[model samples]
Target: MSNPLSEAEDSPLFITSLAKGLALLAAFGAGRPSMNLVEMAEVTGLNKSTVQRSAYTLEALGYIAKEPQSKRYRLTPKSLEIGSGYLQTSELIERANPYLHELNRSTRESCNLLEPSGTDMTYVSRFASHKQISIHVPLGQRLPMYCTSAGRAYLSALSPEEAAAIIARSRLVAYTQNTETDPSRLAKIVRKAHGDGFACSNEEYYVGDIAVGAAIVNAEGRPLGAVNIAVPFSRWTLKDALADLAPQLVNTARSISNAARGLKPLVSPATG
Candidate 1:
């Protein structure tokens, strides 16, 4: 595929320096909470000088800080404002929160609201089950579309051709022994989700984690996101989940979709 950033590099309006600074920030993630200049350079594919400059700028802006002892740069609490701003202003999330809470209360299981971002689904909101569990999913987690129930549910709401194209673009790497990497088989699962009104994953992403999801659509039938309910494998079987929880999940998703249709359009440019 063509590199969009590379293509934009020559444009007069494109700010290479700003992009580099953002890339430096993006390099810090779940397992990588902090990094030294050399590590930043390696992760961001930037030179030491560029990493130093970006880190300096971020530190000055209070987005990141250099540790006194380790000299490793880490994001500051202020950096959370960026994500917090989104959560605060998201009409969809606000509308879905009450229903998500209701689902959580009724099922006493982990529930999440995930939105599509490219070939992956991103968690925008999450409610943890108080019950003992093996997995802990935090907000802002991103998982592959093909192997995740939420992702497949979102894809299932799309046209077959569109869903197939997205699956084609995915890496399809096996995340676990049970992860299905075959594109054709993945397509079949998506089709089943379309017919069934919900999709499920059987320990594809994480061991002992089973999840079912249904897509939230706009009035026009475009999928905006997905609502997911995840349970531990030791406590629930796929048959039990399908028989007991799928109806609730699908109904909750449908209710959210109906509510979302009445929301005003967000004042942001479309990413694509």
Candidate 2:
């Protein structure tokens, strides 16, 4: 599909109702919910006319609803239907969850099933290892593309140009003293992870914690996401984090890749 911003201002394929509707659904995020027409227009870059129609259609479809007092649109619990339907049929999640559990049980550390979200990463599924002292990251927590092992693993799976774009946009915060904020250095690190088939981060996203991850890609080599095992600095140093968990994480991710052999890329044009 041509870049809608550059191509026909209103190509029907580009103006696809499904695409526009899903874009409206995606417009809601962690900080921004209950969007007024302007916020929705800004996020979707669609005209108020288009956004208004999309919102009304979504509300009628039970995917979104208008707030009583605010008069802004918010996704309903029914909005989960789209994601839940995908999860229900995706062999990747069903096959990968057990391995996350096995790794967590063996390592006694939290493990996750990651999925790419543009340049960022998110957990589609996870099993906690620190049940007694577990860091409970919910199902859809987003992590930085630059500072997270899961993010880097997904980055490592991208084409050089794609990965470079992600790195360039990242502010590369020094989440901890050990974080790598330089773009060139981070590129080299991602390149190394690409070559090594794994990635690791020590207190880069979460301070005092370390994670090692590996990417799972489809036959086209497009990244499906990744899996990681995380342990705290108090429980293990960076060296120990890699030494102890790297092999298990790699094994689990490979298993997911093996199972996701025919996975298709989700090129949601409007959202992408």
Candidate 3:
């Protein structure tokens, strides 16, 4: 497949400087929250001078802030506006919020709305469980596609060829002892998810996190996102979760998908 960004860059309409500035901003994530000039250069693969210039520009724009004591640059509250802008405008998020809350309330587990991004799934919205023993996955966290129930649920909604292509492209690195890294085995899992109408992962992505998910499909049957319920190993077994929560999870995903079909097209389709 051709690179869309490369194609745009080759055209006269593309702005290289703007892209560089955005790349610098994206370099700061959950793992690397604060960074200095050297760290920014390494992460973005840009020269120190270029990183310095971008950092300065971001600071001036109030998107990033420099620590008074350490001089390390971190994203400011202003930077959150970018993601908040999307959430505020997203029809899918808007439509899914009520259902997500309901699912969380009924299941007493962390319920999440995830969208596929590259070879990972990004958590867009979550309703936390009130229970003391629960996994806390913050919004914007990314997990591997191959080992996550949400990712597999999205894959199960796609055509076999499309699903296989995505699996072929994934890194498939082992995140835990239970993570299935083999492409063939993972493909079989996806196939089963397609047959079962839902996907599940038992300590595949995280050691103690067990989750079940179903894809939210559009009118044309393409997946727009996924809804998942995550339970800790200490609280529930996989068999119990499937028996008790799977039906509700499937129902929630269907409701979200139906609501999503009535809304306008999303800014971008969920990708794998």
Candidate 4:
């Protein structure tokens, strides 16, 4: 059998079955949560016969269910279970879970682990630390990278030219009063974040929500993602938070980075 993935170097995601299975699930969207075989083929850009076979495979695996009346396909709760299993084993969640609770206990603010997905960022893992200023979103919530502290830190790893190009292509709307809309201004911020080893946002992405994040670098100094601490406006002033908490944020980032670089793990391994 010929390799479909090697045909496109951009997509190293080689496994045909896995790709088709995920594509089938992604075919269902907001307005069209349920899709027929033809609609799935249209959405996925796959052949109708391919969609039919994959849909059958997905249904057998309990990842999707066939709507008997509508003759449409919709994701099953089991699909979400598969995603949850990935989240459970993810290095981000494994390392950040305890720290999130600790930050919550000390500062009473929520914490999140963000992973860069192209020009977007996703909260792959998060812990609800504060009851008062909690934001509503699921585990896989994706948002614009240009407007967020976590996203900014990831962007910081890029060259100024590459960074500017990304920002230019992004939707720089005023998500909040402090959101940086100007491309030049945002580029400067990303550069500074690279230099400072941290990124800061004061009610920029979301109103009354301030966030701070630092880049996580691996052994080759390549950025892995970003770890962030979010505090509600009612919790602390920007001046006070930056002064008191910045050191902790930077230290935590360093710890995570070092761990990823084969340093001592945060959690001790089980002994036989």
RMSD to the native, candidate 3?
1.7
Q: Tell me the TM-score of each prediction against the true structure.
A: 0.93, 0.78, 0.95, 0.75
The candidate with the higher TM-score, 1 or 2, is: 1
Model 4, position 84, has a per-residue lDDT of 84
lDDT of each: 0.89, 0.80, 0.87, 0.75
Candidate 2, residue 26: Cα displacement in angstroms equals: 1.2
Task: Tell me the tens digit of each residue's lDDT in model 2 across 149-265.
Answer: 988988898887778877776667787788888998889999999998889998777767778989988777888888988777777887877777788788888877877879875
Candidate 4 — what's its lDDT?
A: 0.75
lDDT computed for candidate 1: 0.89
Candidate 1 residue-wise lDDT, 50-164, digit = tens:
8889899999999999899998999999988878898898989999999999999999999999988778888999989879967777788889999999999988998898888
How far is 162's C-alpha from truth in model 4 (Å)? 4.4
Shift in Å, residue 174, candidate 4: 4.8
For model 3, residues 88-168, the per-residue Cα lDDT tens digits are 877899999999999999988889999878877889999887797546677888887778999999889888887887887
Q: How do all the candidates rank in terms of lDDT, highest first?
A: 1, 3, 2, 4
Instruction: Give the worst 10-residue stretch by lDDT in candidate 3.
Output: 263-272
lDDT by residue for model 4 (56-75), tens: 99999888898889878888
Q: Which stretches of candidate 3 lie over 4 Å from their true place?
A: 263-272
Candidate 3 matches the true fold with a TM-score of 0.95
User: Highest TM-score: which candidate?
Assistant: 3
Where does the lowest 10-residue lDDT sum fall in candidate 1? Answer: 263-272
Model 2 stretches with alpha carbons more than 4 Å out: 1-11, 16-18, 47-49, 132-136, 157-162, 165-179, 217-223, 261-272
Q: List the RMSD of every prediction in angstroms.
A: 2.3, 3.8, 1.7, 6.7
